[model samples]
Target chain A: MSGIQDFVVLTLVKAAPLIYAALAGVVCERAGILNIALEGQLTIGAFTAVAVSFATGNPVIGLLAGVVAGALVGLLLGVAATRFGVDQIVAGTGINLLALGGAAFGLTVVFGQPGASAEVSALGVPGERGLIVGAFVAALLLHLALYRTPWGLRTRASGENPRAVRSAGIDPRNVRLIATMLGGALAGLGGVYLSLGELDLYSDGMTAGRGFIALAAVIFGRWTPFGATGAALGFGALAALQFVLQRSGVPSELMQALPYLAALAALTGIAGRARAPQADGVPYTE
Target chain B: MIRGLAIGLALALFAAAAMLLAGANPLLGFWALFRGALGGVPQISETLVQTTALLFPSLAVAFAFRAGLFNIGAEGQLVIGGLVAGVIGARLETSGLIAIPLLLIAGSAGGAAWGAIAGVLRARFGGSEVIATLMLNIVAALLANYLVVGPLHSPGVAGPETAELPHSSWLPALLPGTRLTVALLIALALAFVLRWVFARTVFGYELRAVGDAPEAARRAGINLAKTAFVTMALSGAMAGLGGATIVTGVLHRFNVSLSPGYGFIAIAVALVGDLDPLRIIIASFAFGILQSGALSMQALAHVPKDVVSFVEGLAIVALAARRFVAGRKQMTALAPE
Candidate 1:
C-alpha cells in the first residue's frame, strides 16, 4: 500500500542521523576506542551547525562547520586517550559533560536564549532526501573502506592486537587517533542532519539519547558498518511506530520508551555472542 | 594528594576563564560563588541540602567502582526509587513514624529490582553494564514520565508530578526554616558504617581484590558472580535511599526535574574522593557548595549557571590530564632513551 510506502520512507528519513552516528561508533570501536562521548559530539555538532547556519544563511556551510567542530573534540579525546593515557571511558565521559555544559552555555551566550536557538535556514532538499541518500552512500563507502582497503585492515588490526600493528611498522596510536577523529566528523554529520535536514533549529538536550542508542546499534550489528546501519534503520522504524502507536490509545510516554527498551533487549540478547575488539578501552603503555 | 591539589588549581583556572568569557570579572565571580555558597546560615543550609542529596549517589558509584564495575544507571535507579516512595507515601495510611521507614525500604526495593536487571544481564549473559545501564536509564525515565503523566497525575495539579505526600510522611527537618533534613545525619552515619565495612569486613577485602585483579580474586576462592550481583544490588540500594530522601525529606513529592544529573556528577565526586567514604563526605560538600552557588552566580554575575557544569567537566578533564602527564613521566623514567 502507498500508506505503508510513505511510512517506510518517513522512517528511513528519521534514521539518517542514527545511521551516521552508528557508523561513527563502528569506526572508533574498530580502532580500539570506546567513545562514550558520542552524545557530546552530537550536541556540539548540532549547536555549531545551527549557529553557523543562522549567521551565514547557508545550511551547507553550517554542515561543514559541524563536522569540523566534532573533529576538534575528537582530536581532544584522542590526545587524552592515546597520548595522555587517560582511561578512554573517563575521557569520553569528560567530553560528554563538557559538551553538554558548553552547549547550554552557548545557548545563552551566543544565541541570547536559554533553552533553544532560533530557527535557521532549512536545507534545500525536501523530505530529508539529501540526508537519506547521504546516509546510504556513507554506509556503502565506509563499508568498502573498512573491508576492502589496506588502511582498514590496519585499523582493525590495531584494535585486535596493537602490538601486532606496531611490529608491522605502523603506529597503532596514530591509526586510532585518526579513526577517532574521523568518527567524530561522521557523528558531526549526523548532528548536522538533525539540525538542518530534520529540524530547523537546535534545542537543549535534543539528541535525546540517540548517541547511546547508536552505540547499542554498533554492538547489535557486531561492529560492522552495514550491519550497524541496518540496526539503526530498524531502530528508526521502531521510533516511527511509536508515533503511530500514540494514536491507538497507548500513552505517548510509554510509546516513547519503546526504542530504548528495544535497544536494551538487543544489547542483552546479542551480548553473549558478540565479540568486541580485544584491545578496546585498554590504554597503550608504549 | 598533591596531584589532586594541582587538578583543583587547574580546574579553578579553567572556571575563571569561563567566567571571563561570560563577560564577568573572574575574581568577582569566584568570590561571589564561594560567598553565596558559604556566606550565611541560609547559604550553608542550602549547601548542606545539596550535599545530602549527592552523598548517597556518590557512595553508590564508589561502591560499584570498588568492585571494578561502572554502574551509570544510578539516575534510573534513583528515579524508580523516588517514584515508589512517592506512590507509597500517597497511598499508605500509616502513622508518620511507621510510614517513613516503610517508604524508604520500598524505594530501595524498587531500585534494587531495577538494578538487578543489569546485574543479571551482566553476570549471566556477559552484557556490558555500561551499555545495559545506559539504555535502562532512558527506559526508567520514560516509565517515570508515563506514571506521572497518566496513572499518577494529580487532579488540579499544574505540573507533571504526583500529589504531595501527607504531612506525616515528611522527614523531620534538621534545620528550622531550611530544606536541610535528617537525611544529612543519616548519610553521615551510613558513611561511617561504609568506612568500617571497607576497612574491616571480608566482603570488603573481596571487593578490593576483585577490583584490583579479578583473576587473582577468583583464584583466591572469591565468587565473582555473587560479588558482582551483591555489589550492584547494594549500589542500587544506596541510590534508591538517596532518591527516597529527596522525596520524603527535600521535595516531599515526586517531580520530574528533581535531579539535575546528580547521578553522573556523583561519579566525579567519588573519584575526587579517591573512593574513600570519609573523604567523599568532604568532596560531596564541596561540590554541593558549587552546585548551590551556581544559581547565585547567575543572578549576580549574569553568568549562566551552566558555567558550574563546565567547571565540573573541566575537573574530570584536569584529572585525566594529570594522569596522562604522570603516565608519561613514568614511561620516561623506565626507558630513559
Candidate 2:
C-alpha cells in the first residue's frame, strides 16, 4: 500500500508537465496545425521563466514571461506554417532549434553564467497531489472547450476535413493559428512547472526530451484530451519508476534506460493504428 | 535556399554578438575559431582528432535517416558501445592484434543488439521508431552509468571508468602527440562502402524503396520488418565503432561526456549534407570547424562555450524550416502539375 501510494504520487508529479504539453498539442493539432515545435516552445518558456523569476524574485512574473515566450514562438511558427505555407514538421523543428539557439544566447546575456542559470526562488504551485488535480481539471475544461464551443467545432472541422470547413465559410488558417498559440501558452505553463517545481533552476537542455515524451502522449492518446492525459501518466510512471529503481543499487544504468525502453515499446506498439490528423503535416496555403 | 543562407548568416551574426561580449572583435573571434580549429598542420591534425569522434556517429545517423528511420538512440548506442569497450578493455589480456579487434567487434555487437531491440519493437509491435530510439538513448546512457559505477568499475580508480586497456591494444596514433588515429581512414572507407551499399546494392534499392513508401514496399515484398532490423543493426555498428574509436584513439579508455552529443549533432549534419555520404564530407568539415572554433570563441571572447552549440541549433532550425518551405513549394508545384 505504501509502495503504491509512493508510485502514485511520483507518477502524478512526473506526468503533470507531460499532460500540460500534450493537452496543448491536442488543441493545435485539432485545429489542423501539426506542431513539432512544442519542444522548442517548452525550452524557450523554461528559459524565459527561469531568467525572469530569478531576476525579479517572483515566480508569477516568470510564469507570465514563459507564456509570452512560448506564444511568441507559436506566433512565428503559425505565421510561417499557415501564411507562407511551410511544411509543418520542418517549421516546427526549426522552431525548436531556434529556441535552443535563443536560450543559449540568453543564458549568456541574462545569467552571466555557463550552461545554465543560477538557482532562483521558485513559487510553489500545487505539488504532487495538487498538480494531478489541477491538471485534471484543466484538461477536462480544455477538452470541453475543444468539443463544445463554436471554436471547438471549427477547430475539429479544420483538422478532420479542412476543405469542408472552408466550404462551410470557416478560415482554417486563422483557427489553426489561434489554436497553436493557445496550445503554446499552455505548454509554456507546463515548462514553468518543470523548472519551478522540480529543480528550482533552469539549465541548458534541461527539459531532457520531456517535450518528446509529451509528443508520445499526444500520439498514444489519439489526440484526445483524456487519452493524452492518461498516456502522460503512463509514461510518467515509467519515468518515476526508473528513478526509483536507480536508487536500489541495481544496475541503475539499465534501470535508467528502462523508461525510454518502455516508451519505445509503447511507441512501436501503437504506431500503425494511430493515424495522425488527416493532412496533419500539410500546409494549408489557400 | 536563400532563406537558409539568410538564417545561417543571421545566426553567424548572433554568434559574433556573443563574441563581442567577451571583448574580442567578431572578426578576430572568427579568425581564432578557425585558426584554433584548422589554421595549420597541427590545427588540422587536431581537428582530425575531433573528426574521428564525429565520423562513426555521422555515418550511423545518415544511414538510418536514409532509410527514413530516425535513430536518436545513437547517443545511447554509443554509450553502450563505450561500455562494451570499457568492459573489454578492463577484462581482456590478449594481444593487441586480437584483443583490439575483439573489443571493436564487441562494441559493434553491443550497439547493434541495443539498436536491434528498438528496431524489432518498432517493426514487430508497430511502435514509433522515433520515440523508441529517443528513449532508448537515455536508457543506454543510464545502463552504462550503472555498470561502470556499480558493477564493472575499476577497483583501483575512484571514478566509474574501467581500468585502461593494455598499451599494445590502444590505437596507434597517426601523428605524434595527436589523437588522430587510423580510424579516420577507416571511417572514410566505411563511408565509401556505405555509399556503395546505399546506391549500388540490392539492399540499397530495397531500403530506399521502403523509405519512400512502406506500404508500397510491403506490397512489392521488401520485407520491411527485416530491413528495419538490419538498418538499425548497421547503424548501431557504425555508431559503436565511433565509440570505440573515441576510446582507442583519444580517451584511450571509456569515460562519460566522451560523446558530447555527437550523436545528436549528426542529425544536423545529416540534414545539411542532405543525407548524402559524399556531401557529408563538406558538411562535416563545416561543422567540425564551427565546433572547434567555438572553443576559441569561448577562450578569446570569454563567451560561454555554447556559442557553437547555438549555431548548431540555428542550423537545425534553418534546415528544418527550409525543408518545410521547400515541401510547401513542391506541394504547390505538384498540385499545379
Candidate 3:
C-alpha cells in the first residue's frame, strides 16, 4: 500500500511540469499556432528562474521571472509567425538552438560556471507538492477558459476559421498572439517547476526532452485540455515506473527512453484519428 | 542566394559584436577564425574533412526538404549508421577494398532502417514525421548507448566505445599526413549525383510535385505513401553514409562525441542553401569553416565555441524571416486591387 501510494505521489509530481507544458501546447495549438518553441522557452525559463532565485533568495520572484521570460519568447514567436509569416516550425527550431547556446553562454557569463548552476532556494514544501497541485488547478482553469469563456470561443474559432472570427469583429491575429504568449508563460512555469521544484538548480539540458514529450501529449490528447492532461499523467506514470524498476538492474539508459518511446507509441497508435485544428500551422496574412 | 549571404554576413557582424563584449578583439578573433579554417595546408585539409562530414547530412536534409518532409531524425539516423559501421568495422576482417564498401552499405542500411520507422509511421498512420522523428532520435541515442556500455563494450577499454577497426578497414588519406580522405571525393560525387537526380530524374519530378501539392499529385496518380517512404529512406541513407564515412575516414572508432551536433547544423546548411543540392555544397563548406575554426577561436581568442552555434541559430531564424518577407510581398502582388 505504501509503495503504491508513493508511486502515485511520484507520478503526480513528475507529471506536473509536463502538465503545464502540455496545457501550454493546448492553448497555442488551439489558437492555431504550432508552438514548437516550447523546448527553447522551457530552457530560457529554467535558466531565468534559477538565476533570479539564486540572486534574490526568493523562489516566488524566480518563478515570476521565468514566466515573464517565457512570455517574451512566446510573443516573439507569435509576432514572427503572424506578422512576418515565418514558418512556425523553422522559427521554433531556431529558437530552440539559440536558447541552448544562450543558456550555456549565460551559465558562463552570469554564474561563472560551466554546465550547471549552484543550488538556489527551493520552495518550502518538499517534493513540490504545491506545483503539482497548482498544475491540476491550472488545468481545470484552462479547461473552463477554453470551453466556457467568450474568449475561448474566439480562440477556437480563429483556429478553425479565422475568416469567420474576423467577420465576427474579433481580430484572430491578436487572439492568436495573446494565446501564444499565454502558452509561453505556462511552459515557462513548467520550466520553473523543473528547476525550483524538482531539482532546485539549473543544469544544462536538464529539461531533457520534456518539452517534446508535452508536444506528443498535445497530439495524443487531440487538442483538448483535459485530454492532454490525462495523456501527460499517463506519460508521467511511465516515467515513475522507470524509477520503480531501476532497482531491477535493467539498463537505466534504456529505461531513460521510456517516456519518449511511450510518446512515439502513443502517436503511432493514435495516428489518423486525432485531427489538429484546421489552421493550426497556417500563417495569418493580413 | 544573395539574401542568404547577406544574412550570414550580418550575423557574423553581430557575433563579432558579441565577441567584443566578451572581452575579445572582434577583428583579431575574426582573423584567427579565418586563419584557423583556411590558412595553412593542414588547416585547409581539416576544413575539407569537416566539409566532407557536413556535406552528406546537409544533402540528406536538402533531399527531405525538397520532399516537404522535415527529417530532424538525421541525428539519430547518423548515430545508428555509425553504430552499425563501428560494429561491422570491428568484426569484419576483409581487405580494405571489400571492407570499405561493405561498411558503407551496411551503415546506410542502418540509417535507412531508422529513417523508415518515421516514414512508415507517417505513411501508414498519418503521424507527424516531425514528432516521430524527434522521438526516434532520442531512442536511437539511448539504444546506441546501451549497446556500447553493455554488449559492444571493448575489453580493457574504459570508454563506452567499440574496439578499433583493423587498419585495412580504414579509408586511406587523400592528402598524406593529413585527415583529408577520399570521403571528400565521395561527397562531391554524391552532391552532383543528387543535383542531377533532382533536375533530370522522373522520380525526382514526381517527388517534387508531391511535395508541392500532395492532393494534385495524388490526382495525377502519384502514390503519396510510397513517395514519402522512398524520400525518407533516401534521406536517411544519405545521413547514414555520412556516419559511415566518419567512422572509416576519421574516428576509426565510434564514440558519443562522434558528431558534435552536425546533424542539427545540417538543417541550417540545407535551409541556407535553399534546399539546392549544388548550393548545399557551398553552404556545407562555409559551415565547415565555422565548425573547425570555432575550437581554435575558443582556444586562442577566448571566444566561447558556443558563439558559433548562436550564429548558426541566428542565421536560420533570419533566413526564415527573410522567406516570410518575400512571401508577404508575393501575397500582396497576387492580391486583387
Candidate 4:
C-alpha cells in the first residue's frame, strides 16, 4: 500500500541525519574520545551550510564548507583532550556551548539577523534522496573499514589500551585526533542534510537534539557501525510514528520523550550488559 | 592569582574580538556592560538577583564534582523543584511562616527524587551518570511542558505557566520594590555551611576520598554506591532550593523558562571556583554581571548578548587547563603531608 511505502520512505528520511551522527559517535568513542560536542558540530554544520549557501548560491560548496567547519570543531575537542590533558567531558561541554553560542553570533554577523538565517539555495529532492542512501552506504563502509582494516585495529587498540597502541609505535593521541576529525565530518554532513537537504533555511534549535539522540543510538547499538545504524533506523521509525500518531489521542510530549526514556532504561542495562571501551573517555597523557 | 588575572584578560580580549565581528565598538560594549550591571542601586540589585539565582546551582554542581559524580541534570532538578513548589503554592492559603518552609521542602524533595533516579542507576547498575543525567534533562523539560499545559493547567492562565501564588506566600523582599529577597542570605548561609561541612565533617572526608581516589576509597572500605547516592541527592537538594526561591521570590510562579541554562552555566561557575563552595559565590557574582548586563549591551552597543555565552564557553575551555594544573598541584600537596 502507499501508506506503508510512505511510512518506510519517511522513516529513512528521518533516520538519515541520526545515522550519520551515530556513526560519528561510533568512530569517536571507539577511538577513545567521547565526543559530547556532536550537538555543537551539528549546529555549526547546519548554520555554516546555510550561511555559505546564502553567499555562494551553491549548496554543494556549502556542504563541503560545513564538513570542514565540523572537522575544525572536532579538532578543537581532540587537541583539548589529547594535547592539553583537559577532561574530555568538560571540554566537550565547553565545545557544545561554544559552537552553539558562536553559531548564534554568526547568524547576526553573516545574515544580519538573529534566531535564524534567510532562505538559501538548498540541495534538491534528488540530493536529499542521495543523502539518505549515502547514510546506509556510510554505515556499510564504516563496518567494513572497522572490522577488516589494519587502521581499524590500531584505532580499536587506542581505545582499549592506548599504552599498548603506543607500544606498537603508534601515538594513540594522533589516532584519536584523526578519528574525531572524521567523526566531525560525518556529523557535519548530517547537519548539512538537516539544513540543505531537508530545508532551505537555518533556524536556531532546528537540529532539535538529534545529535543527543544519536548518542542514544550509539549506546543502543553497542558502539558498532552496523549496530548503531540499525539503532538509528529504529529511532527514525519512532519519530515517523510520532508524526502519524499525532492525529490520534496520544500526548505528543510523551511520544517525543520515548527515545530519552528508552535511553534511561538502557542505562539500567536493559539493552544488555555490553561494555564500553576501557579507555573510551580517558585522556592519553604521556 | 596571576593565572586568574590572565584568564580575565583573555576573556576581555575574546569579548572585544567578538564585538569587532559584530560591528560594534569593543570599548563601548565594555562600558555598556559595566554601566548596565553597576550603574545604580537598581542595576546592582538586579545583578545580585542573578547572582542569587546562579549561586544555588553552582553550589550543587560543585558538591557533586567533589564526590566524583557529574550531576548534569541540575537544570532538570531545578525545574522539577520549581514545578512542585508552584503547584503546591497555588493551592495553599496559609500564613507565610508556614507556607514558605513547606513549599521549599516540597521543592527540595522533588529535586532529590529527580536526582535519585540517576544516583540509583549509577550506584546499583554501574552505569555512567553522565549519560543518565543527560537523558533525564530532556525528559524533565518534556515532562514539565506536559504538566503545565495539559493535566495541571490552571484556569485563567494564558500561557504554559502555573497559577500565581498568594501575596502572603511571596518572599518578603530584602530591598523594597526590588526582586532581591532573603533568598540571597539563604544562599550565602548555605555557602558557609557547605564550606564548614567540606572542611570538618566525616562525610566530607569520605566524599573527598572518593573523588580524589576512588579505588583507594574502595580499599579503605568506604561504600562507593551509598556515597554516590547521598551526594547526588544532596546536590539535587541545593539546586531544588534554588528553584524554590526563584518561584517564591523572583517569578512568583513556575515558568519553564525560569532558567536560561543556569544549570549548564553552573558547570563553568563550579570549575572557575575550583569546586569550592565559598568561592562559587564570587564566581556566581562575576557571571551574574554578564547575565544582567547582556541586555543593555544588546540595546546600547548593538552587540548580540549571545557573545556572553560565547565568551563563557571559551572561558570553560581555557579554565579547564587551569583545573588540570590545579589537580596536579593537589596531588603533590597530598604527598605524605
Q: Runs in model 2 with CA error above 4 Å?
A: A1-12, A28-39, A75-105, A125-134, A157-177, A197-199, A219-222, A234-258, A268-286, B1-7, B18-24, B213-221, B321-337
Question: Using TM-score as the measure, which candidate wins?
Answer: 4
Is model 4 an incorrect, acceptable, medium or high docking prediction?
A: medium
| Worst lDDT 10-window in candidate 4 chain A | A274-283
CA displacement after TM-score superposition, residue B121 of candidate 3 (Å): 1.6
Models ranked on TM-score: 4, 1, 3, 2
Q: Please list the residue runs of candidate 1 whose C-alpha ends up more than 4 Å from where it truly belongs after superposition.
A: A270-272, B320-337
lDDT for each residue of candidate 1 in A1-286, tens digit (9 for 90 to 100):
9979878987897788899899989999999888888888898889999989998999889989999998888887888888877767667777888899988988888788889999889785663687789888999999999899999999898888899999999999999999899999989889888877889899998898889889988987889999899889988887788766766887876656666676677655644567777776666667
User: Which candidate wins on lDDT?
Assistant: 4
lDDT per residue (tens digit) for residues B87-151 in model 2 = 88877877889887888888888888888887886567645455567667767766776777776
What is the Å distance of residue A102 in model 3 from its true position? 0.8
Tens digits of per-residue lDDT for model 1 on B240-320?
Answer: 888899999999988877788887888778778888899999999999999999988888888888988877876765555
Score residue B195 of candidate 3 by CA lDDT. 86
DockQ values for all predictions? 0.52, 0.43, 0.51, 0.63
Q: Candidate 4: lDDT of B254?
A: 91
* Candidate 4 chain B weakest ten by summed lDDT: B328-337
TM-score for predicted model 4 compared with the true structure: 0.97
Ordered list by DockQ, greatest first: 4, 1, 3, 2
